[model samples]
Target: MTAKPPTPVRRFGSIVGTVLTYVAIWLGLVLLIAGVGIRWFWGRITVRDMMISLQNVDLPAGYTREWQGFYGIVVAPLVIVLILAACHAGHALRVRTRRLGAWDQRPRRQRRRTRALSLGLALILVVTGASVFSSSVGLADFVRASRSTMDIGDYYAAPEVTGSENQRNIVNIYLESGEQTLSDTNLFEKDPYAPLEEQTSDWQSIEDYQQYQGGGWTMAGLVSSQCGIPLKGTIAPWYGGGNTAPPDSIRTYLQGTTCLGDVFKQQGYKNVFMGGARAEFASKDTFLQDHGYDEVKDLDLWKNSGESEKDFRPDWGLSDQRLLDHAKDEIDRLHAESEKTGQPFNLSMLTLDTHEPATAYDYCPVDTESRLISVYQCSMEQVAGYVDYMKDKGYLDDTAVVIQGDHLKHMTSSDSFHEQLDRNDHRSIVNRVWVPGQENKRRLRPGIDQLSMYPTLLEAAGLDIRDHSAGLGVSAFTDAIPGGSAQALGPRGYRELVATDSKDFYTRAWDGEEVHG
Candidate 1:
């Protein structure tokens, strides 16, 4: 204004500043898109899950939904819409400026500034990309390094063509802290009260189709049993950092795509998830949906409902007995639906009553955590009662029962059994597949996983096995045992797969590798 020195240049300078701002914005957006995408797969997207997955991220007090869009479906459309709007606005502005005769007056200086801004943005992208792939963003490096798909159509792949000819309902009854030995017949061995048998029956000996000695408790060893994969994920303390994976757990670990549910769905069977929790990996919702499951009962929902607790109150809600009853009702409902739709029904039920913190009172005659075995006996009663109900309802014969434990109790945590009981050599994740009266005994050695549950069950359930790729899950019952895999005692081993929250742990795995792209 003061002398109007180079009016054209001044206008150009203003344009240049605006161009620089946009350039920076664009560069920032690109970095954000790339950087965030890398993190999403590496970590859980939940506001809290971020802390579990990323080493460098910290969640302060009361941070929720401050950011979103971890999944591609959510983020993609948003980005496209924003870009289109900006482009439209810019085109209109240019047209108006040209009509106003401002195009001719717009300065070369403005173009120069725009070019400079673009250059700066390019530099920032370079820096961000390098940092992202470097030790600073270890997640990208890990995912790129370990991601592997299944071996489909290969000779090693399980045959899917004739998997469902013979049908058996697999019931895996997991007794947490189950008594290690056969002494406490109450929990597992046998039931004695009315005109019943002797002291107790060695629960498993009488009928054995396929079974296993999975190492440790529910999660650690149980995952191995189901997948025939090594239990290599976050331990109790350290979660997903060093060298473990979940989606991998689903793919490489469980190799469970060929699992029971999928096969049934493929063969015109309805997939239904009836359980007592919003299970983390049950993929309950996703799996059922993918397989076209019609009815799903999530225990998580019931616990939070406004209904009276006492009426439906068991420790986890709707005791195993109640679940069986519910199952009967659901089966009837399903049959009605099936009659209409003419499709066979597949039901997957997860029992939570056997889980700890049961409504059992401490002073109650059965109130005893004396030894790990005693505690397990109590829980087994819960399971026994459920099984008895199934037997009574006559579903026992009609249904292919899979009576197996999900995991061992805390008594089986590592070798720390002494703390829970004075026993040694008793720690094992006991798993079994009950085929009503069929005798096809195949047990995974100790040190296996529950992730093996799906695929193994698929084979047992008369369904063709699909992709069991990199899954540590190979059916211990049928998978070729990798010698020295567990050296511990079973067909499997437990490796605590972790990502590094500590810079040291991250750098250790990274071996101080530098990135310069």
Candidate 2:
């Protein structure tokens, strides 16, 4: 029997040879492709392309050519190689399993080759795709002006919280996709998101403030509007997020890292930081804390429980209604403190009820058609409802409601929106301020951003500490409120304002610490 076994050792030399050859080919191909893509993408060439990324950041003409070339050659390629290697290793292991082993000898060298091939292919696909996609994202598309036309130093502030008031109560509401059209026919009235006007018709009195176009995304517009973080340089989701450090914001200096919230907190005002979305998303909490918030409210604590995905609502975790459910409780707490100290309160509500990808809330009219309009109206009405709720609680009269959009949605700018609504438009921020009673009646202002809203509220309420300088768009109700033309200062002015703001902030938050804070 032993001698008979020597007669046959499974003669499959041809099969083994063929598989090994193919494995080698794929391995080489994957590596070649991945290496090429990594080098090209990682270069980060700042060669001035007219195309501006969402943050209006582009490889400036004469930027760092060496760095760009480095990415194309070293950094990105290395990352790509690693990613591809992982994928290929998995594939190589899979190919050497019992089934494939019948055809090949499962040689260690051959297995290694096949794994590298699979991994390289995966790396090439990922890096190449990201590079290509980043080139065309909506943020990069809308910016038409070259960097030369914009001045970063004008609006530039160093890394510090910019302050404007001593005890101004600031409330910024970021509407999901609030786009205002020529006829007031918003695009949020459809399947995904509903309009706020439909639910809270009381806002019908003031609809002119919600503007559209210019900068489309939130990081671009909201960042610029709120903190004077221009839509000019370095777009975000930046690789390092400009390092979430205090004294880095574009607000003011007297309080340094201290914003309107810090200003009020110092003035004995309660800083209530509330948001309907993830509280910790995008270091918003860090920014708030540096600016002087004692407690940043997490609107969706329910989502944190050790529960399955099924527990979440169609809108992810909670609806605007659910958040509204607790609005009274939050407000009551604020009121209790206000009563105790006779000190004013600062309420910053960063709402996400109007968030897109899920149009869970009812539109203002209840008859939805355009998704952009519908969702915005729903959120706006929620804004209105919040006011009413406050009115019933007697807090509405004193509270300065700042309602604005986080940024516009990309889906709304696609060809589908053009065909559906017969329009080509970008989502604008819902940057309107609502102040009840006689004080605001004489000067009802228009739209603004989270950054600007903070300072503007402080100003309107007569709460100034350090002088704010880098603001592009003035307070909606600034002393010289634009009474006629709503023509906002162009992108050039905005860029100038943002670029120069942060230095002043740091000058106050840190450099000026001995003099101010």
Best lDDT among the predictions, by candidate number: 2
Model 1 agreement with the true structure over 402-443: per-residue lDDT tens digits? 555444443211222333233323433334444444434544
TM-score of each: 0.47, 0.54
Question: Candidate 1: global Cα-lDDT?
Answer: 0.43
User: Taking the tens digit of each residue's C-alpha lDDT, what string does model 2 give over 261-311?
Assistant: 544666677676666565455445555665666777663564663434442
Candidate 2 residue runs with Cα over 4 Å from true position:
1-170, 186-222, 231-258, 304-316, 361-381, 412-428, 444-454, 464-473, 479-517
lDDT of each: 0.43, 0.46
